[model samples]
Target: MSDTNVNPQITDAVTQANVKVVGDAPAIAMGNLYQAAAKSTGILFQNATGTQQQGALAEASTNQGVMQIYAMDTAADAATQVKVAETGVADNLTGLLTVLESFKDKGNP
Candidate 1:
């Protein structure tokens, strides 16, 4: 206990272990960097796929709404034609045209 001398073999072993760690540091660091980069790339791909799917859903919804609007317009036109046929006369615009003609005649005079 009084002699504070460390054995030469123990000192050499410790020194070799420290040197091994130092020599491997760059390889270990590079491996860690590559792993992190790969994980980030995977996450980016996942996000892109999710966005694409959402866009597809929105497009489909918009197309469905447009079709519904077209159908409604067609139904309205058909109903108007039926009414005109049943009445045997298309008088809906006649009154408006008469008023417009009067206004035109007044303006000309």
Candidate 2:
């Protein structure tokens, strides 16, 4: 055979492939890091959303409780007013009966 060797060409091809892979390593690592950061940000957003929902629910519950208390107070006030009116009516009826009795006594005399 001729003295031309193919080993040098093979070595050069292998070396070039290795260099390309080594050069791309940083890019691959950066892409992976970016994906991880995005995932972390999504998790944080979800947590914040959950907290806000909880706060809204708590506020609604407190408002409902306050409304209930107000309704009870209103009902109690109405009941007190009715009781006072009934007492006044009863007093008036008693006075009228007493006056009628006095008129009857005078007529009998």
Candidate 3:
């Protein structure tokens, strides 16, 4: 007979999932939403800065259309600068990067 070992967590997860509807995380839906919003806002703003920069770069040589874009660009730039200067954000980002680098996909065959 051919030998193959199924991953234990996959089996356990299936069993537990079938037995239980959901976990504590799912039971508190609004709390999860607030948590997600709090956690993701920073990441989203980081990305949004890049997107806004690209958009501004695209419209660099344009005529004065609306002041809204200019105000947004200025605010975003100031916020990022403040975030960089405020606390241990650099160290936190470095730690996150290191953790990501350390993740080796052993499951990939």
Candidate 4:
């Protein structure tokens, strides 16, 4: 207790203000912690969404590549059919046997 001449009312008001600040400290800290947690949760969801989208895009691209390969195979078969039709001879083991038979008949005649 100092022997100063400060008013009792003023001292009481200052003491109440300090107590109020101290009382609010825990609530302020908890609010900040909740805010940080919410932000971290939001970031985690955003990253998950991004990875899912990338995986979907990769799947789509792979499917397109497979479709292109199938299309190329069909196109090659069509070209071979056209060539076989124009030449009137198949290019297989049966075709080779037919040609050999024809040569054998010609040689015998």
Q: RMSDs, each prediction?
A: 10.6, 14.9, 31.5, 12.4
lDDT of 4 by residue, 34-86 (tens): 99999999999999999999999999999999998877878778999998887
Q: Can you list the residue pairs that collide in candidate 1?
A: none
Over 1-109, each residue of candidate 1 has an lDDT whose tens digit, in order, gives 4979899999999999999999999999999999999999999999999999999999999999999887787877899999879765457578778888998898764
- Candidate 2, residues 28-89, lDDT tens digits: the string is 99999999999999999999999999999999999999998877878778999998987897
Superposition TM-score, candidate 4 onto the true structure: 0.63
List ranges where model 4 is wrong by over 4 Å. 1-3, 74-109
Estimate, for each residue in 24-79, the C-alpha lDDT of model 3 and write its tens digit: 54768878898899889989999999999988977874635555556567877889
How far in Å is the alpha carbon of 83 misplaced in model 1? 15
If candidate 2 were superposed on the true structure by all CA atoms, what would the RMSD be? 14.9
TM-scores for every candidate against the unseen true structure: 0.64, 0.59, 0.23, 0.63
Off-target runs (Cα >4 Å) in candidate 3 are 1-35, 61-109
Question: Which prediction has more favorable TM-score, 1 or 3?
Answer: 1
| Best of the two (1, 3) by lDDT | 1
